[model samples]
Target: GERAASAAARAEAAAATADARARGDAEVLARLKVSEAEAELRGARERLAELAGVEMQRQALATELSGLKAGQEERDRAHAAELARLGETFSGLAGKALEAAQAKLAENAEAVLARHREAAGQNLEANRNSLAELIAPMRETLVKYETRLGEVEQARSEAYGGLKEQLAAVASGQRLVSEEAAKLVSALRSSGKTSGSWGEQQLRNTLEMAGLREGMDFTLQAHQAGEAGGRRPDAIINLPGGRQLIVDSKCSLNDYLAAVEAPGEAERLAALKRHAAAVRGHARGLAEKAYWNEFGAAADFVVMFIPGENFLSAAMEHDLALLAWAFDQRILLAGPINLLALAKTVALVWRQEKLADEAREIGKLGADLHAAIATMADHLGGVGRNLGQAVGSYNEFVGSLERNVLPKARRFTEMGVERGKKAVAALPAVDAAVRPVAARELLAPPADDAAA
Candidate 1:
């Protein structure tokens, strides 16, 4: 029975072990199923949560879109109103800009018209002046001729049978004719309508107005010298102090007028060159003349005096080469200012000459003074010697009186009136001899007196 019990126990233990093994396998399978169910549940929950989150996001986006649409509508309305206002403002600004532009254009147009009118008026005035200047000479010449003709007609009509009256009328006509001819010659030489050539007239007028008289102190003339060899200067002015100056009026009115009237560049240039050449030729002629030699040849050089400043300026402007040429030949050119300066220089020279004369007189006076001083010195030496001799004779006379007469006079006085009378009676002989000696001493020279 115990053996049977052991077998049973062993079987029971084996079955229990197999049952435990089956229970373990079933537990593992159950745990695996639970884990798989837990996994599926967690996945389903996660899907459900994802759906909820997606629905929430969609709703939030719809809310945001609704807000954005409302804001966009408001912005559209504000932008439309602002755009309308901006259009109106821009239209007003454009209108103002157009008005301002039109006003400025009108103002500029008026200014341009005014400038054009002013320029035209100035041009017209210039043309008129030029024309008048051209016509003036002809008009003057015509008037002069008419006057002369009228005077001649009058003389012929008024002539009488008397010889004196007829001769007088003839002389008058001749004088008129000569005067007119001289005027014509002047006009021709100057190529202008001036009474005298401008320079000559100005010089004459200035001198006259300054109280200068010709022939009393000086002589002025326009003369041509040199038979056929030397040059003839324009004017020879002789001064009071035996001084002479040559003033050559070098002005080419023809060339200057031609240049002024030339309408084209080529003509103007040619005229200018001609003027320069004429001026240079005149300058050379003046240099050759050495006209300064007229007054003892005292002056240094010839003065090339231009009548008009314009002529000198134009010549210099056109060609400075002529200036160099003039200088090379010892020709001195002078314009109006230079002419005035020269006159003043001449005045100063006159004053200087006077001063020189005074200086010479002073020199003579100094020599005379020196001679007088020498003579006075000789006279003073003689006087001093005489004075010394006089002083010596006076002292000697006092000594002689004291020594020869005092003791006798004293003895006579001591003897009383009778003896004194007797002494006085004896004094006549002594007085006679001493008076003669004193007279002889007075008749001699001081030098003789000193010797005695």
Candidate 2:
């Protein structure tokens, strides 16, 4: 535009010069200035030609610009259409996904409701029955308690009547008895009243005091049907590793009681001898049974428990050879004190066995842990080797590309195609009426779906 304006201004100035020269031509001065005017006119014509060439170059640039603008507008339209298609497809996929989620949620909700309703139905009947029957059992139990109360009242009344009769008898006896007579009565009661029940009761009480649990630590009666036949020991003490120790509660103390009640020193000595013999006989009987061979893990000996300390001591004091003789027959004589000591020793043995088992388990666990660590180290070493191999391969491929492929391929800078060429490099410019996009872009997620 500026060049055109300058050309127009110069042309106007030349026309005005011509008019002035024609008017001033008094036939003398006009003829002399004519050559100079012709020279100026010639210079003006040369400037006009230069301006025209510049205008031609400007027209070519304008044509190229118009073509580029047309192609850009066409590509924009194609991009909009592609984007619209992608948006529609995404909306369809999102709608299907939402429907599937809703369907799954509905199915789970129905299943949960069904389960809740079924549980409610089951409990409702139970609750109704409980409400109806709750008072009936209470009334029945109350009547039964009242009956038992009457029986207890009747028993108390009978006991009071018996006590009144016993008080009268005691008053009579007190008037007749002396102090020496009282002492003799007490002695008679102790010696004659002694029985197996007393001894057994004492044995059970001592066992309870020794802190042994029934069933697990000791079985009440050790009897099992086996090829050796059924031989029931009084009790079996459980030991670790399936081992067992037999305990017999029955010890004969009748002859000892007889000796205590003897009137003369000779009779008492004979009865004491008999008591010692009775104990030896019982020990022999236990040895003859030899319960050890019947059990899979029983010890070589069996324990014969004397229920009373005095009875055991009296027999042992009377016969010096009893303990050694019993030991030779595999019968261990244990009084109350000795039995308690044996229980403590067994408890210690159990603890040692438990520790040994724990050590075995810990050793196995350590071995397993060591194996796992070694396996993990092996895997890590293999991974390091694989990574080194991968790096080597990658460097080799990169060297091949740089040293061989890139140097030989033709590049765009060498072409030097002019503006408004028939094509853009290898592609035709007109073919870009609709620009292409990647398939991945067509599958791009929507904004709302992406957030979800």
Candidate 3:
């Protein structure tokens, strides 16, 4: 029984040992799984942080885009407001101009007709009085002159009839003149092409008046071919420094014409509003063309020439800011008078440039002439020095002959040497000295002073 108990205790101890080993193995496995879980957690945390950064970048981009959109909307609103203001202003001006023009026309027409009628009546009355006085005298003079009086009366009636006809013709001519003027205005507004041609013609006339020569000072219908549809400015004015000034004469006048011919005040106002819009549209178009960019040496602003002062004034009357606005678009709105003045200024600039060129040429000529004179003086100085040297040499030779050779030769002649009857010519020392150069440029400065 003792042995069995001891064996049982040993078996229990072995079982206990196996159980502890199993527990330790389970703990190690659990520790390895926990470490793997911690690593996965750290990796997940990094991925989450990367996702947050991506979301932040997206939000930032969206915010920037929103800001840009808001800015664009603001600009659009301001532009729309400006356009509305311009329209309202133009409408009021158009109405006033139209009313004033109509009233003036009516007043002038009435005054002219009244004056003519008064003059005709006064002349007729005077003639009638003179005829009556003459007839009375004739009737008193002779009854046989009654036949001649009848003939005279018939002739006077025919003359009066002719005079009435002439008055009617004059009235008709005046009406015709007014009609013709309206027709001419209408013709100018008939089509874009016609308006453009007329504007160009007016521009040419103005330029000519400003003394600008075509092809030299200015070119008409200048066409420059390009990849993007080429630019064809109505006129390209040549500036002094090989620069250009573009002028576009294709300004739309249809709306302006409509405003002029509108039957009612409301229609006229609407037409004038349209006219202002058209002008703005044209200015915008010119700005887009950017002629200055195309022509390397072109002026920044292009001239938009309106053929009539009234056309420009009518538009500007309502929209006070029209000129400033156009200028902002790199366009200058020029009427006939304004364009004429600008052209005159350009002509003056050209004249001044020509004078400058002539002055430069004169200066160059003067410099060349001075250089030539300096060179001639230098040669003359050299010749003077050489002459001085020759004079000195001649004097030295004369002294040597007189003191050494000529005296010995004379002694020989005294010693009774038979010689020719002709005696040796007496050599005299030269007294004259070469004249020094008078010019300061020819005279050299002292060597020490020059070094200093």
Top candidate by TM-score: 3
TM-scores, each model vs. reference: 0.42, 0.45, 0.58
Which segments of candidate 3 are over 4 A away from where they belong?
1-183, 415-418, 421-423, 446-451
Q: What's the best-to-worst order under TM-score?
A: 3, 2, 1
Write the residue-wise lDDT of candidate 1 on 1-109 in tens digits.
5435544554554455456447765434333333333433343344455445655655665566556556655755675566556557776778677556556755775
lDDT of 2 by residue, 1-452 (tens): 54465456546655654665577633323332343334434444555555456556556655665565566556556755665565576767776765565566556655665665566555555544543464444455455445544644554456477788999999887866866565644554456444444555666666666776677777766676666678888778889878898888655755787788899999988988998888888899889888897766778899888987888888998888999999999999999899888877777787788899999999999999979976876676577667667666666776776667655443443565343544333311221122233444333368998999
Better of 1 and 3 by TM-score: 3
lDDT, model 3, position 144: 29
Query: Which is superior by TM-score, 2 or 3?
Result: 3
The clash count for each model shown is: 0, 0, 1
**What order do you get sorting by lDDT, best first?**
3, 2, 1
Q: After superposition, how far is residue 368 of candidate 2 from its true place, in Å?
A: 1.0
For every candidate, C-alpha RMSD to the true structure in Å: 47.1, 62.3, 54.3
User: How far in Å is the alpha carbon of 448 misplaced in model 3?
Assistant: 7.4
**Candidate 2 wrongly placed segments (more than 4 Å):** 1-212, 226-229, 257-271, 408-410, 416-452
Query: Residues 315-409, candidate 3, lDDT per residue (tens digit)?
Result: 88767888999999889999989999999999999999999999999999999999999899889888888988899888888888888988788
Return whichever of 1 and 2 wins on TM-score.
2
